[model samples]
Target: MAAIALSVSTVKPLGDRVFIKVSESEEKTTGGIFLPDSAKEKPQVGEIVAVGPGKRHDNGTIHTIDVAIGDKVLYSKYAGTDIKLGTEEYVLLSEKDILAIVS
Candidate 1:
């Protein structure tokens, strides 16, 4: 799908899901030639723009997610569902798919 660059404020994730703004892949090589879309590698790292409240438990308490909004995270290569709002690209994935906080 074509990329959409929308304001991130419009999204809200629920039930341990997160809204991540995926990092852009390389645009040019050392020779300064721009890479085609087919040559660009999908980025595995992204910044958390929005987060869910947390996963609710059977006991009625909500367990917090490890990552917070604004955190840069590494996730499974094929984890999230890709989405576009306006002109920005985003990924919607469950907390379990996040491998680590980039720090």
Candidate 2:
């Protein structure tokens, strides 16, 4: 059996979910002080690289997700599932995890 390599140019969530590439924060402070690896704060914002189709209601209606790909967004500090693409790390989260979309 051959292993398949998946190259995702656009990620689409199936339902009320979104895919995000979590941006790593700068390690050095503005004052030029380098924070230790353990002291670095977790990034709360990321760019939306992929989005789910929409949310399904009990009434059989679909509620569309607001965020689109390439949009920047803010999320909870502990939300999302971590994934690795090539050499980069990313996050897979539900639409509810997205707190706000930044301009």
Candidate 3:
């Protein structure tokens, strides 16, 4: 029998954060107005792709994060650490930076 792969590549995050590839929103208005690429609004919500174990507090205790991979989350528009993978952009931020999880 041929073996089948069931898992994908995993990227582990360091410290108390995770890396996420933000999904791009539409660049056109409902009325058929085409907005330039530079005029697109940044999204405040995204899916979690990779996550850190947890963060250590000032008192030395580890505070585990609540968000996990594949979860949709809301965050601040200007928050998170931005990085580039190939031609795409991603964000690395702590779970604390996440505002809420979309049900």
Candidate 4:
């Protein structure tokens, strides 16, 4: 897919969604073996780059999302839409897909 460059100043999520800057996959192992681009495992942890306004409940209230910008989070490995902006990679996924906030 064509990569659309997103800047914090230019992009915003409309609901309980988040935009994450994906941590790079490891290039080399502790055993000193370098993996090819096609062989590396996808990283599930990343820093939240941007977040949406809270999700609105049916009772007419909004519950604030637990995550905020700069929070490092763990997500399901198969979750999120992969996107590339310039040379950097990012993931766009719902707040529910975020499994935990990493310290």
Candidate 5:
């Protein structure tokens, strides 16, 4: 058996997929109450880390994705596959899973 090292730079999303680094969840409530780790919600916001070329159209043309790397976006709550690299968290999802680009 062989061992391969996977790093963030080596990850590339294929075909309309986007790789995002998840943002940290809120540690406290708006009311100034501290929340435990288990009570923290999975954040829907993330920054785009890697993106695929684009989706192929019926005519063989590529329909480019709207978001770009470094763009902060909001995605579906349970949309993408969760990934953990070292101590950071990421998600790989289709373009459709993204709801909007945050300013």
Candidate 6:
């Protein structure tokens, strides 16, 4: 099978979906102990990179997504599909999967 190249600029979500750049996981503990890659947990926080257009309602109205690109947001763990572009990690999630917008 032929492999297709993907870049952050090339990926776009359909409806009410968002693309987020995953934050780097902490490499050290408070006690100054370093963590191995196997010990690091997936970070639940990320910055929004791309967003889909508003979802269409049955009445033909659109409910726009509240979050915008560059907004830091906390999302549900295990939510969304994980995507890797080069060395950066990202996730594609529905707007509903986002828990809160971090200040």
Best by TM-score: 5
lDDT of 1: 0.91
Indicate the TM-score of model 6: 0.95
**What's the TM for model 1?**
0.84
Instruction: Give the Cα lDDT of each candidate.
Output: 0.91, 0.85, 0.79, 0.89, 0.97, 0.97
With a 3 Å backbone cut-off (N, CA, C), the pairs that clash in candidate 4 are: none
Could you tally the backbone clashes for each prediction?
5, 2, 0, 0, 0, 0
**Candidate 3's residue-wise lDDT over 1-103, tens digit each?**
9974422244578778877778777779999999998889887778888888799889989888888889988888888887766666678887778899988
TM-score of each: 0.84, 0.85, 0.78, 0.89, 0.95, 0.95
Segments of candidate 1 deviating more than 4 angstroms: 1-7, 29-34
lDDT by residue for model 5 (1-103), tens: 8997777899999999999999999999999999999999999999999999999999999999999999999999999899999999999999999999999
Residue 92 accuracy (lDDT) in model 1: 98
Model 1 over residues 8-96: C-alpha lDDT tens digits?
78678999999999998889988999999999888999999999999999999999999998999999999989987766679999999
| Tens-digit per-residue lDDT, 22-68, candidate 4 | 99889999999999999999999999988999899999898888999
- Badly placed stretches (over 4 Å) of model 5 are none
Which of 3 and 5 is the better model by TM-score?
A: 5
**Ranking of models by lDDT:** 5, 6, 1, 4, 2, 3
User: Across residues 23-67, which tens digit of lDDT does each residue of candidate 6 receive?
Assistant: 999999999999999999999999999999979999999899999
Error of 2 at 73 (Å): 0.3
**Prediction 5 TM-score vs. true:** 0.95
| Backbone clash tally (model 3) | 0
Model 3 ranges with Cα > 4 A deviation = 1-10, 58-60
Tens digits of per-residue lDDT, candidate 2, 1-103, equal: 9986644564556889988888888789999999998999878889988888799999999999998889999999899887777977688899998899888
Per-residue lDDT value at 21 in model 3:
75
List ranges where model 4 is wrong by over 4 Å: 1-5
Provide the lDDT at 16 for model 3: 81
